[model samples]
Target chain A: MEQKETCFAKRVRCIVKLGGAAITSKHKLETIDEENLKEVSSHLRQAFVPDSTSANVLGMDWSRRPGQSEAPSFVDDFSDQPAGDSESFIVVHGAGSFGHFQASMSGVHKGGLSRPLVKAGFVATRISVTSLNLEIVRALAREGIPSIGMSPFSCGWSTCQRNMTKADISMVIKAIDYGFIPVLHGDAVLDTLQECTILSGDVIIRHLAAELKPEFVVFLTDVLGVYDRPPAEPGAVLIQEIAVREDGSWSVVKPKLEDTSKPVEFTVAAHDTTGGMVTKITEAAMIAKLGIDVYITKAATEHSVKALSGILKGGIPDDWLGTAIRYMS
Target chain B: MEQKETCFAKRVRCIVKLGGAAITSKHKLETIDEENLKEVSSHLRQAFVPDSTSANVLGMDWSRRPGQSEAPSFVDDFSDQPAGDSESFIVVHGAGSFGHFQASMSGVHKGGLSRPLVKAGFVATRISVTSLNLEIVRALAREGIPSIGMSPFSCGWSTCQRNMTKADISMVIKAIDYGFIPVLHGDAVLDTLQECTILSGDVIIRHLAAELKPEFVVFLTDVLGVYDRPPAEPGAVLIQEIAVREDGSWSVVKPKLEDTSKPVEFTVAAHDTTGGMVTKITEAAMIAKLGIDVYITKAATEHSVKALSGILKGGIPDDWLGTAIRYMS
Candidate 1:
């Protein structure tokens, strides 16, 4: 097919991640969180289904939430809208129960493939991760999202276990240029130094955001947002915003209106090979440094949708219900 | 991971294709020919497993067929056999019932994606093909093969609907270099002129054979072999050999014996968008022009295994039963 002469390059792009915990039963083997997947994708549909005359957008109700101010539509501020295309989005999801167990058992993260047994483990891990990616693309398709699964195991090569050596973003770019959302996931990939290693979804997002320079980077997680003292302790507060200055100094701000509530427990899945919440935040911080607005919020909620829509219309919503990470530089 | 300094580059590489009709129920949607898959993979295991005290090999017995000469062992000719690592292979499969229906529905092969409906078809076509790839890889793993699925849609680009414009064989090369079998399948991909089109497994094998220049290219199909007059006819006979010249000339030769009951039907599945037997033979003939031996035979039988193992050991069996395509040049 000939490449269409669409102005895809000029449109604002966004990277949204449905965290493993939010979309899959992370603690249960091969189980997907069906309700959560549907809800999160539905909200994504609302945010990206273009401004007018989209079949998905027609007759859909956007009821206002109590105590929240009315917000403008996500595409209201667009200067030159395409005739039929929606806002471009690339979704990268974490490998929850699907990959974590096999990766942990295989020690693929350590980059070991010297023995035949280890090689077998690498294959097993790849199979598991790919299985999850299939489901992810299927779910996205059901929500009327034009998406395709890109295997990092085949498309990426790494020398350092922590970083990809040849992180080919060309395919992803082409998919976007053609208006298809490329969905990628955590995978065990070939490496120059370690033989093979794990490339987490967070790392993929970090690299993509740097190259694409998307307007927004959202990590839809299980938590309400990043918190001041771990959401579970007595009187622990929500950290609504994180600001980084040009000099690299940063500070976290608490929600303006707070109530004394018991903090919620935040923990990683037992089988998680990659470091959990902390790593996600660190990756988000690096992306924020590149001058994109970042959000860590509970997926599939009305508040999160409002925040996402608000940012796309060119600003953080006044009644934002998530932790926002921004750069002063 | 550090690259191992193994003599993988010097190994006799082979490309095997499990024709869609051979491992999948072409008439039924998403149905797998489980028995055929298991049997073909078993034969593959026997032919490729390095001659050693490996468990899978130790338990396997290769008995000579009645009234035939005693056959040599599959790996007897190898000077040095790895204790556990098998000979490297690259497997490609057609989309069969999985993708053909969707691609036809989307007009993907015609390069139509100018509208939302067509775009959805493109996505649907992709999902269907990818779903088959997952099952193929899983089946291979069950047979003790370390394989990973490589989507041509993401890895290839074309300017024409009839042929690929830029087919990248680098990833396949790397996979072989690292001792991993990369399983690729027919897929709906981006085309410069058409927007998108289906890239068949035949085209992939043709391209890879030219670039990798493997010692052998085998297409394990459901048919016993190509016939002089379609096998089931009263006067039909098996065409056991095809020879191609460096000057692009070719000729098909018939077997010594001939006996037939009726003319066999050579039609594609109801949903298959790619051409059936004729296209496969045409692609095989193209590969033959490159001077590599090509085999089109039923996948699991002893005859196919002998031919495959014979070529790997640097000789063609005198009693070969399948149709062999080779370069006279």
Candidate 2:
């Protein structure tokens, strides 16, 4: 319905991070379930843009609800971001369960303490993560894409004492010269000593993997790869092929999943805390030490974006215990 | 010297995200090193927000870095949202090595494809991770953190439509009700669908651990915790109580740090990115699967945030590596 990208270097960019438990599958207390956030916003617009079925999924606000005591009418929090170019494809997401599931049941991670009462816990996890980022920016404006969300904690946790990194690259190089698909996630930023630290969508996926070094970093996660033992015990094993050896010598090749081996462990709704399996093999060993070749899978599985485009055509998978990391230099 | 806040609460807001690889690490130059961001605007100030050795670092720029033939500066990326609340502490970052390290080194991850710019070997490691997140947002504003920068693909990515989960919590609740401290990083956030993931800082610490649920989920890194092998190897052990028990089991039990650890894996100037140690243990194991209680530590040891406030007042640093599960309802 909105799609506008007529020109702008053809515009097709992306940077994504979404896993608030894949939109409330684990905590739906007050509201937020619009058919499971439009089935994960229709798989985040056909898995990170281009055509996205036909587009049309912007600013979705089904009227809020996380235990509603009152105060947060941030209403459907600001919207308008996500457009396109480079043949038109841009994306950004965050609000798993529409948003910090009531800001992690109201702890406010860093949202000032004492006075924030309206339904506290940092104003209901900042009003359900700003109403699940305006219901995925109205599902990316009903899918044409031309969206926009912005809030890297309002100017990206201040990329330090403002030169605003050249005004945030001249406003994303003027939204890639006026195209779009700017969205972003995680907020509650604003720190000098500490009122918030929750700013990691990989710090905006390593600053867009360092400004569009993209192609792959998929990581959907609920679980589908990397496993050897605590995979819920029993037969255990799923690594697949993380072998990245150049000199860094990394390895972890297990693949062969599906019988519901159940080794991917979560156990059930945050089994008392403490992070699992050494924190996803230490974040897949830091996305294979940032050469970025991570897959992990599970976010509602099945072809998970062509199994992440077969690890960007390198393939791998086959049951994936994988885990290999290298390039440490 | 700013340090006041004895805890009564109210005017003590905070948000600081500075990590574009600690602000252009003295201009290794891939981009935005604007003379090391004008030397982090005279080490930001306000008496350095509460005396960390006599604070005083103060600087603020919402957004605007357009060079490479620039012009589109939304009046220098629109600024206006801090009208007082006095008891403030804000710093956000991004755009250090400016223009996201040359739009992540020319090739631009995938969406700018060329066979993944030569099959992920990294031709520019995405402009050295967009100039190391603008040199960790100008080295935390050259060490006095009252900062602000923005870029989540410029002004927190935006397209047109809206509803990006309430625009990702209304860009961090309107930069914490405008006291400001809403920076963001890991730029190049397009995502109209998928392909670009490490919006990492662990997805802004998992959307602020689901919107300020933060009982604790630190990570810090540069070194200090989460080790057993890589801190340069030789007896590298630094387990320091991984714990986990209840039956999910995990063991290790403290006493290993051998002096903290800390090795974000790779990145001399980027490509071998950071989020290191496998993205700080898989985004601190998905924010400790949401119950919180994960630390990781090291942002430069020394009193290490007062030994992380004495491991945040008690238990869990090794609740036996906490692996609780619930499987999300």
Task: Please report the candidate that would top lDDT against the real structure.
Answer: 1
TM-score between candidate 1 and the true structure: 0.83
Q: Over all chains combined, what TM-score does candidate 2 have?
A: 0.30
Q: How far is candidate 1 from the true structure (C-alpha RMSD, Å)?
A: 10.5
Q: Candidate 2 on A1-329: residue-level lDDT in tens?
A: 11112233433333444555554454443244456455555655566554436433322222113454222232133232323332333344555544454344333454443222211233234434544564565554444344555555544343322111211333443454444455566654544344443454544554554444444555554555455554566775555555554443454433445544443333221321422435444444555565655554555445455543334446554444333332334
Q: Per-residue error at A171 for model 2, in Å?
A: 11
**DockQ for candidate 1, C-alpha atoms:** 0.18
TM-score of each: 0.83, 0.30
lDDT of 2 by residue, B83-193 (tens): 223334333343333333334333233342223222121212322343344344434433434233444444444322211221234344444444433345554443333
TM-score of the B chain in each candidate versus the native B chain: 0.79, 0.29
Task: Classify candidate 1 by CAPRI docking class.
Answer: incorrect
